[model samples]
Target: MKTEIIWMIIGMGAVTYIPRMLPFVLFRGKELPIFLQGVLKNVPFATLGALIFPGILLIQEDIWYGILGAGAAFLTAYLGANVIVVVLSSIAVLTLYSYFV
Candidate 1:
């Protein structure tokens, strides 16, 4: 049982690592097309929105909490902040909301 679990873990790791690493290995020197580059550049923002939108709609206690955080995230992202900064700003807004309300 333990050996099977270990093998499963190894398989999962390889499944994840290969797709990520394969691109770098295969496209080391090539420049992707401009259209593709533009699309790729927006991937993080799109991903963040996809992940957060559902949570915003699903907040049980008060929708205000989700609204505040989402607004902060949107504003920061619009200002071209890093994804980490956008997330942290949203967290800061929510933390403040929790503290006061």
Candidate 2:
């Protein structure tokens, strides 16, 4: 059993190492194509949209409430509200809306 666990740990380490090493090995001293760079620049937004959009639309309750809360949080953040204020304001708005309407 101890031997098995040791081998398992080594196997997992190799698996993790290969993924981390592959990108560096493949991209070393190489400039990405312009199109690829553009795609990469959009990747973060695409990832965020993919993650948030479905949750915003497909939850058990109405989508508008979640959207409104997100909008409020974003507005507050843009206005340079502190993180606590932004979080609290979002919660307050959502709670009030849920309670009253």
Candidate 3:
């Protein structure tokens, strides 16, 4: 609602958006090498793993619960499930484990 807040949001969005867009705009006409393309294709999964791995260790009560959730998520993702499905499957597995314990 405030002018300063509006400007800050726009500035923050631009800062994040520009880096993501810059690579595409700069490389639009160029063909990346096969190895480089393969590496780039795995970037999202690597980043997701990096972010999720830490939280996976922080579970209280039992470490096995966290390990089970991680295994389920990994299995679902490896089976070509969408990211949302991977996350939900992890949650479902953990919830059932908790209920049984």
**lDDT (CA) for every model shown?**
0.86, 0.84, 0.88
lDDT of 2 by residue, 1-99 (tens): 699999999999999999989978898533898888788788899998898776755543887788878888889989999999999998898888889
List, residue by residue over 57-84, the lDDT tens digit for candidate 1: 5665787887788789889999999999
Residue-level lDDT tens digits of model 3 in 1-101: 99999999999999999998999788863389988888888999999889888788667567898889889988999999999999999999889988999
**How many clashes does the backbone of model 2 have?**
0
Off by over 4 Å in 3: 29-45, 59-63, 75-86
The model with the greatest TM-score is 3
TM, every model: 0.57, 0.55, 0.62
Q: How displaced is residue 76 in candidate 3, in Å?
A: 4.8
Tell me the lDDT of model 1 at 69.
80
Candidate 2 similarity to native, TM-score: 0.55
- Ranked by TM-score, top first: 3, 1, 2
Spell out the clash pairs found in candidate 3: none
